[model samples]
Target: MTEIESATTPAAAHRRPASLRDWLAPPIPGSALWGWLGPLFVTLFAGFLRFDRLGVPKAVVFDETYYAKDAWALLKFGWEHKTVKDADSLLIRDGSDAKIWEDGASFVAHPPGGKWMIAIGEAIFGATPFGWRFTAALAGTLSVLILCRVARRMTGSTLLGCAAGLLLAVDGLAFVTSRTALLDVFVMFWVLAGFACLLIDRDRSRRALAEKVEDGVGGSLGPFVMHWWRVAAGVCLGLACAVKWSGIFFIAAFGIMVVLWDAGARRAARVRNPYAGAIGLDALPSFVSLVVVGLLTYLATWAGWIFKPGGWGRGEVAGNPLLRPLEAMPDLWRHHKDILDFHNGLTTAHTYQSWPWDWPILRRPVAFFYTEPRDDCAAARCSREILGIGTPAFWWGATIALIVLVGVWLVRRDWRAGAILLGFMAGWLPWFVPAFGDRTMFLFYATPMLPFMALAVALALGLLIGPARQATVHLARHAPSANRRLLGSAVAGAYLLMVLVNFAYFYPVLAAKIIPYEDWDARIWFNSWI
Candidate 1:
């Protein structure tokens, strides 16, 4: 029987598998074709949304002015270099110029990983708006695909997986970040990838534990699985950290999550003293896989600065006699320290700055771009904008869905619910620490938490939709539970429709399409949004 089929009741979900084969079987077996077809269709839709008018307004929006030039400088010098004054206007006018930089490397605060991603697009498309944003768009597109697959694995339902992807596709914040020249999308991609890898590792490790309860390769110690997937997860997480320092939170949260999953797998496999077994067998390798490997991978992303010449701090560290022996390693450490200091001291006021507490609810969204275009629309006045805000219907619904997932996790011991909560909290809650110091923050930083919010919504929908086969037969269709499921399917479908309508209403501003001033004013739903 499928996992959901076996789960006839909430209590049934907690039951141990009947046999070793049952323990090793796929959860909620689904048609192989729908698995591929559903997610890809949703991904195509997401790609269309992200790529549509990706280069609109023709002006560099918000941080693109910094990142596009940084990418061009990185392409030219293998590291960021200082640009000439009025470079934004110069680049916008003649973006293909290679001589925008002066001598000496620029002291970039963030790591080079995200810039490298931007540099790829610039290499092919030149330093244009389309070029810098190509990576973000591509990453966002793949994020939909990845989230679809992850949800499928978690819920064992293709339709629910597609729903999750569609939610992300319609999310205003995700859509905006994906179409802009920004680092958050890249970091979000890596974080999701790392989590996906660990998820696969969870299944594989469980299968390894199912290899013979009493005697296998490790003999009662839960036979050794290479855990290369976990290692790959580490590499992805490390790459995420390289993209943004905020990515470190996932490394910590996911580390604990994986270890606990290992312990749970042992318990489900009926291993003696499962907690002890996890500590002895799973803990050390997990540390190596997640921590040591992640640290090494993060450091490796600095290859250009380590090997190539003319990077900032290389000359400074190499010149100091006391630190010269260690090369620029000291300078790299000092550079990180300086970056930390800058972040800690960042309390200056800004018009668009938002509190972390308000991010999920989106009380204030950063206005990435805005222009009162002369004669741009049918109306006497028009507003062209790229507002960095999320869809209200989706975000508000997800708030309740997330709360429901928390309750489901506590009441039913659903691992999927707990995992989603952990991912969301890791990306979101850390900002509160900095918030206490009155640190300046923006809504775009909430990008990494969005995928998990989408997942929580999908999981709740899965509960509503129930197993695909439950309502397939006549007697099943007439059953009491079937009636509830029918109602749920209607609700789920209606919610999705609501999400689509909400997205359509806000599409003009989200895509930077010129709109009537009255229409744009209507979209500014809150006073804080203006």
Candidate 2:
């Protein structure tokens, strides 16, 4: 026998052999075409769910009032302009743009990345409901495809990857956010893309390390490697930050995470002083890729405001003490500080705003659209509403699963579990720091974290189902011995079914379907939901 085969054969004789290669490698092997087909099919289903009746309730809903109008202004003026009185009625009802806006820049709080995306849709379809929301729907659909591939890479199981995508597809928060012209959905998409890029970097780097060791070139420390995937991750993360300042948390968290991954990889390759090597070789290049590259990409998103004149807060830094030292700098630098000041000074009270601690428990969901359709309905009373609440069974189950995942990571040091937790923390925990103040946070702010929550639940289900049956085992002899696997699989299947059923039950409220008032009331499980 070959040396490597001989080393593993003794363990294989007693039980299924355990190795880093087996743990990290793809679980199924065959045609790459078949591998992509499953995720593609799931993405199609997600598209249908998001695109059906997308222009319904043809009016501005919730924050769509601010973002939709801003997007249209950005398209026309190259910067956001103040709109005229009753702009919502003029745009949605009258469908007229004549004299709808005044001739000056508006002080938009958020950056222009998401508004620019919305502008693409508006430019194609005109300034209507569908036009404003088209890009959001597209981003949301693409997020499913991205999550499917990422999950597939992490677990090595195409089935589990599609499961993660399917769960995210039906999630009410993900669905609602996508159908609206809001910034949060864009943030979710870019953050998800960044995570997927990092996963690709991990696999590629490990393969290169393995090849080096097999040759005579392996040394006490692992070889330094080039990572195009990490650079791609930086670009995605920068776009995420340009969409919302909150994305900075992810950039910081993921920067540390990729370096730690490199250190762990070196240790797995039996390199001496693995941590030291990771810092020496991988740290500097990774910083340039994620931090420096990300910063430049973020600045590129502001080209509309940067190159043009009369943008809000542009050229207004003459008397400002903090910005005086930067008089030699461009107007864009002053505008950035103004945007930061606007965010820090926001203490406005809002009815539906909830704390971060309340998000995991489904407290204080935002009502995007609501109306009583008495005249058009056959019943005595009917209601149509779009509520941004998550699927109860899925969110609650994911909460429990995340706690368990932490334990798994601590005890077993599973990199997959650790990565999921890091993603959840990056999207979630930062909101708590601002929540302690007077910031007007809402439950929908948790939209970016929903994919990670779905991933945790899917990963837990994979563990419950256990490994596939050995091909060499005799069916009759192993049937009785395999009861534990059978039982675990049954339980996992039942749980997934429950989540599916829960989503179906809540679909009417989520999609703004007109239903009897009694039916709508039945779906509202808590008084707070109303």
Off-target runs (Cα >4 Å) in candidate 2 are 1-31, 315-330, 471-481
| lDDT of candidate 1 over 384-458, digit per residue (tens) | 888999999899999999999989989877888999999999998999999999999999999999999999999
- Segments in model 1 whose C-alpha atoms lie over 4 Å from true places: 1-3, 6-18, 214-220, 316-326, 468-480
Candidates in order have lDDT scores of 0.84, 0.82
- Please give each candidate's TM-score: 0.94, 0.91
Model 1, TM vs. native: 0.94
Backbone clash numbers for all candidates listed? 0, 0
Ten residues in sequence with the least summed lDDT for candidate 2: 1-10
Candidate 2, pairs of clashing residues? none
Top lDDT prediction, candidate number = 1
